[model samples]
Target: MTIVNQLKISAVSIKGAKALEQNLLEKISKEKYKPHDLFLSLEKISNIYNVNKTTAQRALHSLVGKNYLYQIHGKGTFVAPPAVTFQVLVIADYETGTNNDFGSIFGIPAFLRGVLKKIDLEKYNYSPVMLTKKKFIEILPDIELIYRSCRGVIFFRNIDIFVKTLPVLKDKNIPSFFYGSDALLESVSNADCLVYNEGGITDLAINHLLKLSHKKISYLYIDESPTQKKRFNLFLQENKKYKFCTENDILYFKTIKELIHNNIIPDIKRLLKNGITAIICGQEEAGVYFLNKCLMAGIKIPGELSVLTISNYPICALTPVPLSAVHIPIEEDAGRCLELLIDIIEHGSKSEKHISKTTIVRRLST
Candidate 1:
């Protein structure tokens, strides 16, 4: 699902899907789609080709991965001409799933859009290079070369990358901007960072759940980063004011996939038995899964178990019960951070630190 049309071409094994892809790619290659000419929508492609929506999607993705087409999430795909003369390098994890773009994650799209709006498109277009954390470090030297060439950079990923990349940017004098919470910056040094007030989620969590007098609140998360652990700990300390949660009322996982695959029936049964009236999830995916499991167990949401997550991913809207979330101003922060980097690159402005704003979005799950 790595749709780097400029870098890789994937083999499409499905006969019908590959044929559709070939048809579309051939037209695109023949310049049927002029520069910036929007490609057909999934529904339109499906109806015209007499194929399923999945086949149409795969076809479009094949072209994008082959660099024949490029997508702008809500905006339709378009034929790509010669590569843009890119000045800014945006680094993001290439989420390995079909239909995922830079905007697939919660905060990234907003941040990316905000940054894009401020970018001087005539002088500097952005080159987004998406790679997983492991992939980035595996090709660290190659990555550094790309960084050295860029006028500026926008980064969002693991601290390992931050630790390695910040120094390279510093040494090369390529201004860099980082996006994450303040907790992520604890171990890192001398990096210009944009920290969204992710810690405010705890305030949102406490206010919403406590207002309802939810006793025996449970917190669950994948402690993949310091912020996740910090958020869980912060919740614990804050809840101490009311003494709502205890030792057995919390659980965690190493990954979201593990949390999804592992049976949560026992956890649900035990928590309910222990008088757990509400639950706070550190991620939206976990909130969705919890709701699904609760439905299966004939449990009423908010009635039996109030659920809230710290994310505002689109899945919140898609879930049966729209998930309550804390909306951090990562998008706003990213735009400002990008402006900072751009100014440093063009005007030799000094790099500085800034924190993002945070707020709550309540839905039925709360």
Candidate 2:
């Protein structure tokens, strides 16, 4: 095995074989020593580096162990084909409360649990990262290195980072998939995305309630997020479809305080007195808070006023009444993402992309 003109390298000979090792790594990663190309023989490296054959052999074996090069029984060493790494750059958005382990975070987020569960641990390494949007410009260089190093990326609910990093990823030829809601991501189109059909949640919930003989269904929620607004608009559309538009059927709360700590008894009694037989909550946490308030008021869920919710996470499932809800198929979406990513890594970005569907999980609350 031979590589010409790399006859001499000097980087603190005290670092010894380590410097020689770095030189070889630079050559391979830069594609100077390409796949199946013979690397410098141990004898040549030993002479060039002015190191013992044992030291050169150790350096060669280190690259072999890392799969950068391979040694045939009697044929010396040759560069191995660049292996597609299992490392995936998982990007997460952080608010006031969260954590990060260096570039990667430690604890898994609720949405990420399903993703991690469906990921092949033996073949894939999921790296969760949280970089603040405010610091985006400052961290651009570090972010670029991350994109270049990873074979693929899995981003959850971080549209800003996903959009900003797309160009760098394209420059590095890295494939990425961002899982989020349709409402929040409607404007972006260049990257692969798994969108929670926010409107579908409204359709599913409304259809379910209407089928159960619920004519006077009202919409209620705090935190008018994009997904919530989308859900509400869809609900209005559905109501229009059935010619059931009534201003009294919609209740909007300004904050979580209004749903939780603020007086809600009058609101509950008002709905019942007005023959509002059911309520569709825009957010699961809001629904849970409302449910607890109802229970405190001795109101029977489903029996008195059926409760339906749009579940972005597992908040509804943890309830005592098991609220009937329109759910994002979190695990299914994640599984599909994993499959799509594997296909992209193996067959290129032209590999067919598939998006998972929103679903309805019926329970006692409805």
Candidate 3:
């Protein structure tokens, strides 16, 4: 049966139930919630649609078996919020004539939507603007003029652009936030941020790998940026306690080409031959790239070399082997950053910084 028909067949119930279900479906259709988050609380639904409790409960019950809402043993129901939108302003060298950078502003955008359900606007009002580093420098006067009109500005990619522009905002008392791993912020040391917990996240992933009986664990990364270096150090620091991973056990790579140039495949082969059975990645994109590289070299994942990634990027879910990753609480962190910025703009609170916690999601690829 068609999905729509199936829903229609099941939605036919009491008048109030039908009305409540219609209200919810309309919200879902308009909001485009993921399939995983359809169950809504009867109380909330009733309160939102102004229906009686019975009708709301019946309406939710009708959606129960239709894959719209699933009930847990004891926890109350929750309807997922609509998709989120985060607008990031990036200044970078896009035409460097190399492969495109793996990171994007989309991850934090998706995350913000999930956590900021209480906000009236779910999507960002402005379009994300990408400017070349030179263009950004040249257009600073005009850019600052344009920036004044924006409700909020999110910066990724170039730390220099942010570092320079931030002074302007600081002078003007304009609230702004940065989202990424590598941004030089000693000048704006007091600015708010939504960044990975390089030390804590790496420590957790390495500890997990150590417990899995993998002695010689290799570290994979994209750029030798400060954030990646911090993560590499954290990985080694955590493993150092176990005596299995000394300086030799930790390996840092600049890029895919560099890894290949230095004969990484041969080195990995040697590690495997010498009983290295796992690898931890500094970021999700690097993890996916490393996994592909290992596969090309005919190495099996988990069975031969367990793989773990630090950042939880979207590609992890779609990879051949879903990656086990320490996920930054990006959405919650972004939402909190937005809230803090808005509050400071309105109330003029004087806070220094906002930091979010991280957690590990053990998936199939671990």
> What lDDT tens digits, residue by residue, belong to model 1 across residues 156-266?
745567777777657766677777777767786667777765566666776788888886788777765346557667667765776666766787778777777888878
Ordered from best to worst lDDT, the candidate numbers read 1, 2, 3
In order, the Cα lDDT scores of the candidates are 0.71, 0.70, 0.63
Worst 10 residues of 1 by lDDT: 94-103
Writing each residue's lDDT as its tens digit, candidate 2 over 278-300 gives: 98887656777787788788999
lDDT of 3 by residue, 209-272 (tens): 7777776677665575456556666556654754544456556666645754565676677667
TM-score per candidate, in order?
0.66, 0.69, 0.62
Name the runs in model 2 displaced over 4 angstroms.
Answer: 1-69, 72-85, 94-108, 121-138, 144-148, 226-245, 351-353
RMSD of 2: 10.3
**Which candidate gets the maximum lDDT versus the true structure?**
1
Could you tell me the lDDT of residue 4 within candidate 1?
75
